[model samples]
Target chain A: MQKLLDYGPLLLGGAVTTICLAVLSLLLATLLGGWGARAKLLRPRGDPLNKGLIRLQARVATAYTTLARGIPDLVLMLILYFGGQRALNWVTELAGLDTLEFSKFLAGTLAIGLLYGAYLTETFRGAWLAVAKGQGEAAEALGLRGLRAFRLVLFPQFVRHALPGYGNVWQVLVKSTAVVSVIGLEDLVGLANDVGKSQRDPFLFMLVVIVVYLGITSVSGWGFNRLERYYSRGMR
Target chain B: MRFDLVFEHWDLFARGVVTTLELVALSLAVGFCIALPCGLALARGHRSARLIRAYVYVFRGTPLLVQTYLFYYGLGVTLGQYDWVRDSLFWPFLRDAWWIALLVFSLNSGAYATEIIRGAVITIPRGELEAARALGLSDRQVDFLVLIPSALRRALPQYGNEVVFMLHGSVVAGVITIQDIFGVTQTFRARYYVAYEGFLTAAALYMAITFVIVLIFRQLEKRYLAHLGLSR
Candidate 1:
């Protein structure tokens, strides 16, 4: 009990790092996912001038999502972390520069972001599709075009539709951040393991770790629920 | 680039493949067995529903890696300190990393399977249940003969996803010194000091396995779900 309390600040710091990693990765995933979704949904019907480019875009997006989703997250992380480090060092040495070290935090975030980005692309595409085709047509009928139409008309509806799936993805992504500890990130799980090993009471320390994870998940679940309710207002 | 190194260490890769397959197969089989009854209970709102829900919530909420570490390093170590546990017949199995991997993976997979099954069971049309009841089938008979069969069919696609997910999740076994596929890749990388070849090869292998899983599930769906096909 005294040892746990002594390590309280360290565990709290680890929890903060975990949250930061998750949020940063979520931002990266949402960015990639949005672009992937747009690329996938690009249609030549509306604009014949760029038909060739759109087809290429859609194909590239399809390949990205397929490859990312098929591989396991841990494998991808290892490949990106170690393989990426080697590549970076090779490039730097070739340029007569000092060999660079790849940060575990960055590698973890990027690997997870890229992996979940595939799933999020599907989620976002589904959400966009769920918004009635009539809605987009209606926006165009009202003489709203391009970015304005999407921002003012389609975006809100997209949010309302995407919130549930987004929340689900967020929850899973948060849990996945724990995998970063394998790469020696000083995240909650990593810290707990270290602390527990030194104290020779890993079971008790692990129970505390589990409770902390449960708390994080439960709190976030509640937040997502509230967000969903807010977005879903004025509709059945 | 280091294809020669990978070829030289082919035996390691083969061993890894066998371990990975065994881990996934055993875990999924055991997980499904555990989940089926729990799922049915949850779907039927049985008296044990709350307990099952709590189990699902805990497993789903935590990372599988954390669960793995907790079981192996935490519980396994703690139990080893006990004279009774050390002297028990089960200690041999408990001390083996493979068994611990199997136990943790199965429990994690079971939690996800339970939810998949419960959702599938609930979405079963009310009329189907009514018809089964109308046919002089008792509740147990209806569940086993009608509900379970249809639910399993409906759950096929989702369960296929779970199987792939389990395969992916089983990579954590590598972290625990299980010499699974990913572990083999790590060993190859460390041994040869080569970067891309080993990990990329493992990636290709995993992708191939996933492709096979998807193909098998597609065939299963085509056969069992033919009635729900649009052509009909």
Candidate 2:
């Protein structure tokens, strides 16, 4: 414990890394989620993309989510770290970019982003379903088309409706950032592991890590509650 | 990229699948056993119910990965040396992958299952219990005859979700070097450089398993909840 306090700077750095991973991944996930939701809602149910194509798209989306949600985040982080890095290196080689390398931060962020994007898809899709159809129709009738209607009408309601679930997803994603440590990311947990190894007091280091996580979870939970309240205003 | 290599390793994959199934089944069975009583006690507001609720909150609030590490590393260090515990007949079981995986997975799911079973038990109509009491039935009789059956119906949907969660969570056993489906894929990826193929195939297997489980859950719900104005 004294060692942890002495090495506070390193621990704080890890916490910062943890936050960066979560925030960046959350940003990417939300963007992808919105796009996925729109893809499902905007496309005509009877579009001539062919039944097989539609089924394939749906299956792909479902697989993305199942694979993300079903497997443990630690395993995902490992795969992303070990396999994904190799795959990325291969791509760089193909592109004739000799000696180019992907950093642990980028790999961790993108891996988590991809995984959480699947979760956000389900949350956003459910939120879209909850949006009253009349809300969209009213915007359409007022000459708002495509982007304008989505911005003016759909986005607001979807954000508000999705806030609660998205908050939960955000918490999950935040906790998931810990797994990045497994991938050699210098996230809070990763740093703790390093310190633990160096100091030979893993329990102390892990306890410190747990405390940091608890702090993150508590603060984020409070923030989410506030956001949920803010979005839920004017409802009976 | 290498179809022949995958074909050659089909038997390995099959064995991996079997191990994964065995691990999941063992964990789920153990989880259900512990969960039933814990849930009943929770719902019944028996002594120490508050403590049980707190237990549930901590387990539910924390990520399962942390729980796994805490068990494997923390518990192993702290409790690994007690002579009776070390030398007991259970030590052989306790010292291995199967036991740790079972213990962690069961406890984790048991926490969730408590909520499901409690909700189901409480959702049974108060009138039914009252009627049983009015019939001069013992409290135990009222519970067994009136409460338990009705509660099971109310709980089926959420319990189904628990089933899916436990099945999915079983994949995490791979992290501890248990050659479950995901573990096998990791091995393949290590040997063959076919990361995407192995992972995608494992993902498909998980989907297939989860799909079958979900379908069975649905059928069970329909059968049990048929009289409740529910339709498939």
Candidate 3:
């Protein structure tokens, strides 16, 4: 108990780091997911020559999602964290440049973002599909085009459809930040483990850590619910 | 890049594969046993439903890695320190990391399984229960002879996803010094300083296992769910 207080500030700092990592990775994931979703939803009607290129783009997106979803996140993280550094140095050496450091935080973010991007790709695609085909046609008929059409008409409906799944993905992504600790990142779990070891009472410290996680999850769950209600205001 | 290193460690990889399969299979089997009654209670609105929901929420809300560490380092080590626990007959099993890993994995999987089962049970058509009751079957008979079996079948597809997730989750067992497939990759990488080969091979193996699980579940669905098929 006394030990917990003594280490309180460190634990709080770790929690802040964990939250930052989750937010950054989520931003990356949403971007990749949007790009992948667009590539996947492409229709090859532009020209005879471009049709094959569009088909290839869709194929590559499919492969990325499938491979990402198939492997475990921890293994993927380790591969990227360790192998990425080696690959980076090899490239630098060939170009007569100094070896660059690949921070664990960056690798952790990239691996998690890439992994969840696959799931989000499906979620975003489904939401886009559910927006009613006629909605797009109506927008075009009213002289709204491309980004204007999506912003004015499509996105509001997409949020309503996507909120539930987006919430689930966010919850899981937050939990997965714990895995970054395995690679020696001083995140919440890592700091908790260190403190617990020094105090020689891991059980109590772990219980505290568990409560912290529960707090984060429940608070986010409530926030998502509010977002859902806001988006679904006019719906039945 | 290091194909030769992977081939040289083929025996270790094989053993790791067996251990990984055992961890997933045993934990999931035990988890299913734990889930069955809790799922029924929740689906039927039994008085225990509130307690079961709390259990599910706690287990699901936290990360599995934390749970693993809690069980192994936290509970296991804490208990092992007590004089009574050390003197007890159960000490032999408790002292082993394998049993601790199994216990945590089972409980974690059990929580997710309960939800899958409850969803399946509640979705069962009301008329089927009425038909069974109207035929003069006892409540227990209807539950066993109809509700349980049908829920199990209906739950098969979602449950298959759980199995793969469990397989992936079991990689944390490696963290606790269990030589599961992921553990083997870690050992090989540390020993040889080779990047990509061992981990890539393990990834390929995991993908293959996932494919096989998907195939097996598909076949089971076709066979058992034939009556519900579109062709019918």
lDDT of 1 at A208: 84
TM-score of predicted model 1? 0.95
Worst 10 residues of 2 chain A by lDDT: A70-79
Residues B1-232, model 1: lDDT tens digits: 8799899889999999999999999999999999999999999899999999999999999989889989998657999999999899999988999999999999999999999999999999999999999999998899899999999999998899899889888889999888999999888888889877888888998998988998899889988888866211
Clashing pairs in 2: none
The per-residue C-alpha lDDT of model 1 at residue A185 equals 92
Interface RMSD of each: 1.3, 3.1, 1.1
Flag regions of model 1 displaced more than 4 Å: A45-49, A90-98, A141-145, B230-232
By DockQ, rank the candidates, best first: 3, 1, 2
Model 1 chain A weakest lDDT span, ten residues long: A42-51
Two-way lDDT contest, 1 vs 2, winner: 1
TM-score of chain B of 1: 0.96
- Give the Cα error of residue A221 in candidate 1, in Å: 1.2
- For candidate 2, write residues A29-63 as lDDT tens digits: 99877766655555435766765566666666766
lDDT of residue A92 for candidate 2: 84
DockQ of all predictions against the true structure, Cα-based? 0.71, 0.26, 0.72
Q: Per-residue alpha-carbon lDDT of model 3 for B98-153, expressed as tens digits?
A: 99899999999999999999999999999999999999999999999999998998
Candidate 2 vs candidate 3: the TM-score winner is 3
TM-score of each: 0.95, 0.81, 0.95
